[model samples]
Target: MTLPFFVYGTLRPGETNHDRFLRGRTSSEEPGRLTGSVLYDGPGYPYAVDEPGGVVHGELVTARPGDYRELLAVLDRLEEYAPGDARNLYERVERGVVRARDGLVMQAWVYVAAPPAAARLRAGGRRIEGGDWRIRS
Candidate 1:
C-alpha cells in the first residue's frame, strides 16, 4: 500500500527538487495543514521544526512506499533528512495531516529539523494564517 506524505519544503511541487524526484511519481498533491510545528531556514534550506502554536504549510502527496524511500535518500544526500544521528537537514517524523474538504486527520510523514540545529537559524518565527505559505508581494 502507498503512504501519504506531507511535504513542506523543497519536495513540494513548484519547488526546486520537485521535478527530479516527485514529478511523475506523485499520485496526488493538495494543500494540507499540519499544526504545532515551526519553520526555520538554515544555511542551506528551510526546515519545519516542531514547536507549540506552529503550523506548517505544505502539500499532501500519496506515493508508493518505495518512492518515499527514494525521496528520503535524496533528502539525506542533500542534508535535508536528519533522522537518528545521521546529521541530516530534515528529520523524518510522523504527524497529523488535515485534509481540506472533510477536515479529517491522517497519519503522514513529515520532516523536521533537530532542535539544536534549528536554534542557529531561529530568527523569530513564521506564521501562516489559514494554511498558506506563498510569499506575497
Candidate 2:
C-alpha cells in the first residue's frame, strides 16, 4: 500500500535530512504520535524501537503523487532497508499513528529499528525521554 510515512527523526521538518530527502516532495506534513514505540539514540539519528505502551512524536508525511515511488525508493536506500536483509538497520512497517490535529488514527509507514538494533536498544541503549527525538540532549 502507498501509505503516508511516519517520520520521527532527521526527516521531520527543519531536521537535517528533511531538505535533502523530503523537501518539495510532500503535499502534507502533519504532527502525529506513534504509540507502541520508543525512541532510542543511534549514531547521529534516533531509532524508533517498537515497544508496547510507548509513544513517539513525529509527523505524518503524505508524498505528492509524482514523487511517491521515487521517494519511497530513496528513503528505503537511505534507511538501509531491504526486505528480509539481516544487515538492515531499520525495517519499514505499517503502523497506526494518531494525527495531532484531530486525534484520529491513521495507518502509515514507519521505519522502526531492525531486529538486531532493536535488541541492542532494548538491552542497553539510551532512550530519549518523553519519546521526542528533537528534545534529546
Candidate 3:
C-alpha cells in the first residue's frame, strides 16, 4: 500500500527542492497539521520539534507505492535529515490529522528534530499554522 507522508520541511511543495523531487510524483496534496511541534530556522534549513501548543505546517502527500524508496531517498537528501542519528537532525514520527472538515482520522509520516538539536537552535521561532508554507512569507 502507498504510504501517506506528512512533510513539514524542504520536501514541502513550492519550497526550494519541490520541482526536483515532488513536482509530478505527488498523487494528492492537502493541508495538514501536526500537533506538539514547532518550526525552527537553522543554519541551512528549518527543523521541527516536540513542543506543546506548537504546530508544524505541512502537506499530506500520497505517493505511488512503487515510488516509496525514491521518495525516502529524496527526503533524506533534501532535509539533510536522517531517521536515527545521535544528533537527531530528523526523526520520523507519527502524525495525526483530521482530513478537511470530515474529521476523519488521518495518520502519516512526520519528522522532528531531536530535542537537544531543537534546544541549540535558539528560540522565538514562529509556529506554522494551518499547514500553509506561505504563512511565513
- Per-model C-alpha RMSD: 3.1, 0.7, 2.8
- Candidate with the larger lDDT of 1 and 2: 2
Tens digit of per-residue lDDT, candidate 1, span 43-127: 3346776678877778888875457667556655665454477565556777898877678888887767666666654656433
Global CA lDDT of candidate 2, please? 0.95
Off by over 4 Å in 1: 64-68, 79-82, 123-133
Give the best candidate by TM-score: 2
Q: After aligning candidate 1 to the native by TM-score, how far in Å is the CA of 133 from where it should be?
A: 4.4
Q: What does candidate 3's lDDT look like per residue over 49-113, in tens digits? A: 77787776677888765777888778766665675667556776667854555656588877777
Estimated TM-score for each candidate: 0.77, 0.98, 0.78
Model 3 spans with C-alpha error above 4 angstroms: 122-132
Identify the candidate with maximal lDDT.
2
Write the number of the candidate with greater lDDT, choosing between 2 and 3: 2
Q: Model 2 over residues 1-137: C-alpha lDDT tens digits? A: 79999999999999999999999999999999999999999999999998899999999999999899989999999998999998999999999999999999999999999989999998999999899988998
Candidates' C-alpha lDDT: 0.68, 0.95, 0.69
By summed lDDT, which 10 consecutive residues of candidate 2 come out lowest?
A: 128-137
